[model samples]
Target: MSEQPKTSAAPARLPGGNRRPAGGPPWANAGMPAEKSMTFWPSARRLIHRLRPYRMALLSVVALGVASVGLSVYVPKILGQATDIIFSGVIGRRLPTGSTQEQAVDGLRAAGNDNLADMLARMDVTPGAGVDFTALSTILAWAVVLFVLSSVLMWAQGWILAGVVQRSMYELRAEVEAKLHRLPLPYFDNQPRGELLSRVTNDIDNVAQTLQQTLSQLLTSLLTVIGVIVMMFWISPLLALIALIAVPLSMIVTQQIAKRSQKQFIAQWTHTGTLNAHIEEAFTGHELVKVFGRQKEVEATFAARNAALYDASFGAQFVSGIIMPSMFFIGNLSYVAVAVVGGLRITSGAMSLGDVQAFIQYSRQFTQPLTQVASMANLLQSGVASAERVFELLDAAEQSPEPAAREAAPTRGRVAFEGVDFRYQADTPLIEDLSLVAEPGQTVAIVGPTGAGKTTLVNLIMRFYELDGGRITLDGVDVTELRRDELRSKIGMVLQDAWLFGGTIRENIRYGRPDATEEEIRAAATATYVDRFVHSLPDGYDTVIDSEGGNVSAGEKQLITIARAFLADPALLILDEATSSVDTRTEVLVQQAMAALRTGRTSFVIAHRLSTIRDADLILVMEDGRIVEQGSHSQLLAAGGAYRRLYDAQFTSAAVDLDESGAAAVMAR
Candidate 1:
C-alpha cells in the first residue's frame, strides 16, 4: 500500500470547552535560573515584554488615575482660601494664619488705635458676601466640583485597573495551560499534581489579584509622591526639605521589607501546595485511614504541614503588614513636624500665612501615595512569585508540531519492529535492540513477568513513546511519519485498568468514534455481549457512570470498553487480558467477545494466564526487557525452553484450568 501525505491540522480547543480557549502560551524558557524555588522576579525586559501587548490600555488607565490623584491634591487649597475669605471680610483685616483676626486686633491699644477696630470690621462676614461672594463662592463651588470629580473618576480608574489586570492574567493563564498540553509527557509524570494545580490555579490567581491591587497603587503613588513634592517646594522650600528627609527613610523601610518578603512569599506558596496535597490525600483515602486506625497519625501530619504553612504565612504577611502602619505613623509625625515648624516661620515673618497653610496640605498629599506604596508592598511580592511559577511551566519543551503520516491506501495491519531500543530516560534501556513482526490478521501474544517491557513494546507500536534506536512500521510505512490521530485511529486498546470516564455509556463508547451512530453502537455492544447486561440496566445506553464508574461491576466496565473498541473498528487491537481482573466466569465472556472482535484483525494480546494464549499464531516470552523465547506454544513446548518453564509453573500452581475445546478452537483459527 502507498502512503499519501495529508496536511490538514487538528483544530485546537480550549479547556472547559466554554470559550474558543487557547489554554496558555510560552511565557519563558524551561531551564533558565535554576533556583531553589519557583518564585522569581522577571527581568526588566521580560516585564516590559509582558506589558508591551497591553501598553495602550495600561497607558490610558494610568493617565486617568494620575488625573484623578492630581485633582484630589488641590482640595485643601480651596479650604484654606475659604478660611482667609471668611476672616478678612468679617474683621476688616488680614486674618492671622493661626488666629489671624485675634492677632491683628491685639496689635492695637484700643484708645489711639481705631484702625484696629476698622481692621476687625473688615474681617466680619455675618450676613455673608452676597454681592461680592463671586470669587469666594466660585472657589468654594470649584472645590466641591473637584472633590466630586475625583471620586467619580477614581471609581472609573479602579474599574479600568481591575479590567486590565484581570484580562492580562486570563491571557497568561491560557498560555500556561496550552504549554502544559504540549509539554513532554515525562514532565507531568515527574511533577506533583498539587504543585501543578497551584501553578495553574492558585499561582495565576495570586498574580492577577495582586496586580489589581499593587500595579495601580504603585503607579498612582509614584505620581502622587512626585506631584506632592513639587507642590510642597512651591509652598515652602524649607518645609519641603524637611519632608524630603522622611522620604529616604520610607524608601529604606520599603526596600528592606521587599527584599525579605519576596523569598518568604515563594516559600509560602510552595508550602501551600504541600499542605493542599496532604489534605487531599488524607480525605481521598478516608477509608484507608479508618481501616488503619491512623486518625491521630494523619492529624499529626496535617498539623506539621499546617504549622509549616502558618510559619511561612506569618513571616510573609507579617512583614508586609508592618509596612503600612509604619509608613502611616512615621508619615503623620513628619506632617505634624512640618506644620509646627512652618507655622513658626510664618509667625516670625519669614513665611507668609498662605504659604504655611499650603505647605501643611502639601505634606499630606505627598505622604498619601507613600502610604499606599507601603500598603501594596505584599501584593506586589505575591504577584511576582505567582508569575514566576506560571512562566516556568510555560517554558517547557513541546511535543513535535508535525505528526507522523498514515497510509492512505487501506492497510493489511502488519506491524514490524526493527532493531528497536527504547528508554524513558537516557540511561537504563527498557528494551535493547529488539525485533519482531505481527502479520496481517494474526493474533500475537506477548507474556512476561512485571517490568519485562511487555507494555513498553505496545506503547512503541502505538507511538506513545519514541523508539530509542530503530524504527517501527505498520504495513510498509514507518509509524513515525504518520499523523498521530490517523495512526491511533487504526488501533484500539482495552487497557488493563479498563478506564471508563464519567458519562453516559453511549458517550463513552462514542468517544472512540464520534461519528458512530446509535445503531452501530448497539450492534457493537451486542457483538461484545455488553448489550445483554446494558439493556437490563434501567437507563440502558443512557445510564450514567459515576467517577471511575464505581457503581458498575469491573467486568461489566471492561465489556463496555471492549464494545467501544469494537465500535471503533480499528484494524489492530491491543487487549490487556486483566481488564476484567480475570476470573473463571468473566474470562469466558471476555474471551468470547474478543474472539468475535479479532476474527479479521491483527491483535496483540497481553495475557496473565498462559493457558488463555496457547493458540496464538506467534508467542513471545519476555524477561527483563528482552525476548527470551519465541515460537508457537506447541513448538516452544517441544523445545522445552522458557515457555516450557512458564507452562510447567502454571500446571504446578493449580490455579489455571485450560478448556480443551476452547483451546483447540482458538488454535485452529
Candidate 2:
C-alpha cells in the first residue's frame, strides 16, 4: 500500500509567474527561486571551497596567465623600438662634431635604459648616421619570437585551466547527485523535478561554461591592465596621467551598467528555468492535454512563458550588449586624449616619437581588458545566479540523522501504529490518533474511499512522511529508532502504477535484490506467473523495458513488479491496488501469486474491489481518516455498518454496468 501518487496535477504557475494550463492545484515555486533567502557571496564562498583541492593547478594556470600577459605587453614595446629603428633609417644622417658615443651613453643613463645603450654601442653605429638595417631586422625578429612565445603560453594556460574547471565541475555534479539521495522526500514534494534536473545539468553547465570562458580571461585582463598602466608611465608620466583619467570613468560606467544588467541576468536565469519547467510539464502531460482537449490552452500557456523568457533574455542581452561598445567608446576617448597630449610632448622633444606611439598602444591595451570584463560581466552574473540555485539544493537540510548507538533490529512481520497523527499540511489533518496492530503473518485489509487516509496509513508505515505525533513500530521496536534503509529493507511495496526503469526485464527484476542469482530470478518470475508471457517475447527475460515500462501491458508490468517483490522476499508486504488494472482472468493469476507470496508474511492490502480481500484475517473499513468498522467480511456484513453499505453500492454498480444480456440475466435471477 505505497502512498506515492499515481498522477499529480500540474502546478498552476512555474517560477517567474509562468502559468501552467488553468484549473489545477495552487501554483508551486517548484522550479522557481528559493523561498529561503540567500545572499550571493555565501554561495560563492561555498563553491570556492569546493574548488580548493585544485588550488595548485589553478596557481599554475595563474603563473602561465601572468607570463602570457607579460609577453603580450612587452611585444608592443619591442615593436615601438623597431619603429624607432625604421624612423632613424629613413632620416639617415651622420653625427655632428662633439655629439660623441659618451654623450649618447649619458643620455641613455638619464632615460634609465643602459642595457639598450650598451646594445646600441655594440652595434657601432655613429649618430646621426646611415640606416642600420641589420640591427633593425634583428630587433624585429626578436619581437616576432616574443609574440610567438606569448601565444604559446596563452594556449598552455587555456589547456591547463580547462582541465581544472572541468574537474571542479565534475566534483560539483557528484556532490549534487549525492545530495539528492540524502535529501528527504518532503523536500522533493515541494520542488519541481525539472528544476532539480536543471540544477544538476543546465545550471552546473552554466557554471562550467563561465569558468572555461571567463576565469582565464579575468586573470589576463587584470594583469594586462596593470602591465599596460606601468608601461604607459614608463613611456611618459605626463601622457600616462592623461590616459589614467579614463580609468575611473570606465569603472564608473561599467559599475552602473553591470548593476542594472545583473538584475536582468538573474531574471533571465529564473525565466529560463521556468520555461524549461513549462516545457517539461507540457510534454510529460501531453497525452493528458490531448485527452482533455487543452491544446489551445497549453499553447497559450507556452506563448506566455516564451514571451516572458524573451523579455528577460532581451533585457539581459541588450543591457550587457551595450557594455562592450560603451567601454570601447571610453577607450577611444582616452586614445584621443593620449594622442593630443603625446603629440604635443613629442613636438616639444619632451618625449620621443617612438615613446608617444608606445604610449598610445599601451592606452589601447589597458582598455581592452576593461572591455573584456564588461562583456563577460553578464556571463559571470548568470553563473553566479546558477551557482546560487545549485548551492541552495546542496544546502537544503538532509534527512534526519540516525541515532548514533542504534543497531539493526530483527523485523519479524509484526507492525503497530500507536495513536498516530499526521497531515499533509499544517491546517489539514488527514489522519488523527489512528491506532492499529497487525500480528505476525496476519493479512490486514484496509478499505476506504479515496482520501480517507488509507494511502496515508501506508505512507506512515513506510516512514515517507514523518508523523506529527505518536509512533510506528515494527516487531516491538520503534521504526524510527532503526536505520531507514534497514527498516525499508524488510518491507516490499507494489503500487497500482508499476514503476520500471529502462533495462531488461530480468535486470528490472534483479533490481529488487541485486545479489539474486539467475535461478532465484527465474523462481520468483515463475511464482508471479510473469514467466508465462516473458518466455513468449523474442528476447524473453532479456527484453528491454522502456522508461515507465510502456513496452508491456499494464497487467504484465504489475506481474513483473510482483515478481520483483517476491524476489526481495520481504517480511512485510504492501499490495496497493495491485489487481485494479487487470482483467478477471489475469486478476485470478495475480491474486494466486500474491497469496503464495504472502503465505508467511504480514501483508497490508489496500483494494478498491472488496471481493479480493474477503478471506483476510482482519478488515478495517475507514472513513474521514478514522476506522469505522473492524472485522472479517462476514462479521462486518453481519454488523450492517458503513462497510456493508460500501459493499452493496459496489455490488449494485457492477450489476448495473453489465451488458444488456447480462443485465437481463441478472434481473431474471
Candidate 2 C-alpha RMSD relative to the actual structure? 5.3
Off by over 4 Å in 2: 1-27, 36-42, 93-128, 654-669
Cα distance off (Å), candidate 2, residue 567: 0.5
Question: Candidate 2 lDDT (Cα, whole model)?
Answer: 0.81
Put down candidate 2 lDDT per residue, 95-156, tens digits, no spaces.
44347666776777689876545544433345667667898889889888988999999999
TM-score of each: 0.83, 0.90
TM-score of 2: 0.90
Using lDDT as the measure, the top candidate is: 2
Alpha-carbon lDDT, every model: 0.74, 0.81
Clashes of 1: 27
Encode model 1's per-residue lDDT on 1-669: one tens digit a residue: 011111111212322333221212211111112233443445323533776677878888778888887887777667667766654455443333445444455565355565444434344333322224676788889998998998888788788778877777778878887788677554654445666777789887887787777777777788878877777776678888998877889989988888889877777876777676667668867989999999999999889878988998899999888899889888888988998898667545465555567677778778888888888878877777767767667775666665644347797899998999876545455688888899999999998777687777787787766677899999978888887777888999988777888999889888878999989988888887778788788898999997577767878887778888989988999977644454577677767778788888999988757877877899999887789999898999999988888788778645433466667889999
Q: Which pairs clash (backbone N, Cα, C closer than 3 Å) in model 2?
A: 1-574, 93-128, 93-129, 94-128, 95-127, 95-128
Each prediction's RMSD to truth: 9.5, 5.3
Q: How many steric overlaps are in each model, in order? A: 27, 6
